[model samples]
Target: MVILLNCAHHVTQRLQKTFVNYGEAMMYSLESCPSPWLRTHSMWGRYTVSFMLIVTQLGFCSVYFMFMADNLQQIVEEARTTSNTCQPRQILVLGPILDIRFYMLSILPFLVLMVLIQNLRVLSIFSTLASVTTLGSMALIFEYIIQGIPHPGNLPLVANWKTFLLFFGAAIFAFEGVGMVLPLKNQMKNPQKFSFVLYLGMSLVISLYICLGTLGYMKFGSDTRASITLNLPNCWLYQSVKLMYSVGIFFTYVLQFHVPAEIIIPFALSHVSESWALFVDLTVRTALVCLTCVLAVLIPRLDLVISLVGSVSSSALALIIPPLLEITTFYSEDISFVTIAKDVLISILGLLGCIFGTYQALYELTQHNFYSRVNFTGGIHV
Candidate 1:
């Protein structure tokens, strides 16, 4: 995985160096490359990259929605008293309803409002606040995780093939930020120092991912929920951690939503008159937020959603695209056979992960949907 990330960074830098005038977006990298295939079908490449990016960003937004709902629901359910005669409304978290869907619906308007603020500078204020709260929340979570961890020998080091594929999807999802590489480098005041920043930052990120994942699994073992937050004890501090994390994720929705909006909304508004631009933008933003909410409601399994998203799109963006881009862009150069072999190997690994991971995730999702329908039908019959 680390090797793959390094490869991605290398390709991204090479792309930027190859095309100095283009913007720092993934689509621009694809469009501006000197590949013969892309030169002939540059527009197609651009649109493909754009579509993948849109899917990846919106998948993130949907995951955020489900994540917040799951954590918030757990917090509320834990906080409420266990009464045999408790009314459905009494069991409700925020709105006058029960279940995760209601929570998603209740949060929809707020999310719409947040994404409506299209200015990156304005959104950064929210991002700053979210960062602070997120740090605090992580501290609390780490405190929770490190306490009384059980023996690691009891747990299986390697899961079965299906679970392994799921893990691959989830892991890919975690590192999907590879798409941001060029943009971050382009924005850096000292672009020359970006390699240092990239390596340092990625090392820290990978370390944290390893620590949290291994520790969380060792701590909770088989009983771990989709999120570590849900596995938190039903105590005030931990509950507050859930809420704090929820707030951070809530604020983060805008930044994730920003990418797709920048792509789709403008293109959509282009078809309309100048007078309708603002209205169309706001409407489109609201509609997109609602779309994510709807997706969250439909497939409320946070873990599976993450895996599915990662496998379906994140794998392509993070794994498949970079090496292929490198190979294509540098085809005319005197590149070594070993370099081509390495690129092909990396691309193959990504393709296998994508195919297997996607299949497993979709299979689980269908099983979930099937059982849900059966239960619903049974309840109706009763």
Candidate 2:
């Protein structure tokens, strides 16, 4: 994060200093860099970055869809089995026992409609509500976690190498907000203080992640589900937590969907006449939303899907690209050898993580043992 922020500081400073005519996005910075070595492949890198961003954002949307479905399914199942008065079964008459995919499909139309609102101002309202609900849910989850934490000796502080790859992938996903760093800095009235903002924000995020991860693991041990909310007691208050978090994730889906739609819809409509542009835009939006829902249904397991997406795309965007971009952008300048070496090392680590993490995630996705543990019988394959 320090290195990415430093690179972003450099990139944005260059944008303000020399590349004032260009855009402030990562792609623009790559395309307009002064280095001759970088210029040759800048176009390719630019397009690749766009593709990766699209994949990362859509991957997030898919994860959000699955997250909402999973939480809602757990809540509804508990309600149907436990509560005689609260009958969600009668409303969702698909079957006495609905699979996870049914829950994904049930919420498809609402998701599609939610993504149709293009105005960020309107979406910001939902985003604020999402934030509030998410914070509330996290508080409840933390309350649950601290209650039954077992001895540290009983837990594996360091997991084995094979399972570590999954952890690495998920960690990358959690820390994969580098794309927003530049945007936030650029929009700030006092851009010089952006570094402080970055430091404080990351500190809080990392601290919270560590607290929740360790305590939740200690509490649940082997029975921990993909989401900690799913492992909560099947009661009214905890079920409300599931519902609140689901609502938060549902609203967040559109925020994630916005970036890819902005990139894809404009490029797609460039080929068509102005008369049919609106129709094409709406069709593409609906199609993109439905596509994420399909992907979520195909891989209903939240943890595995999150790891797969993070390894495949988040590693590139968050870990690999920024350092390489820094090296490429500053290659023509009087950059120190140690700085260059450090950048190369970071990029190499990111590359290796991406390769191994992706392989491990894919292997788990294809294996029967993992599915057997989850009792996954969605028929797409284990």
What is the Cα-based TM-score of model 2? Answer: 0.86
Q: Per-residue lDDT tens digits of candidate 1, residues 224-267?
A: 66777766666677778889999999988887887788789979
In candidate 2, how many clashes are counted? 0
Q: Where does candidate 2 clash, by residue pair?
A: none
Best-fitting candidate, measured by TM-score?
2
Regions of candidate 2 where Cα sits further than 4 Å from its true position: 1-37, 81-96, 184-194, 369-382
Q: Please list the C-alpha lDDT of all candidates, in the order they appear.
A: 0.71, 0.73
List the lowest-lDDT window of 10 residues for candidate 1: 373-382
Find the candidate with the highest lDDT and give its number. 2
TM-score of 1: 0.84
Position 118, candidate 1: lDDT: 72
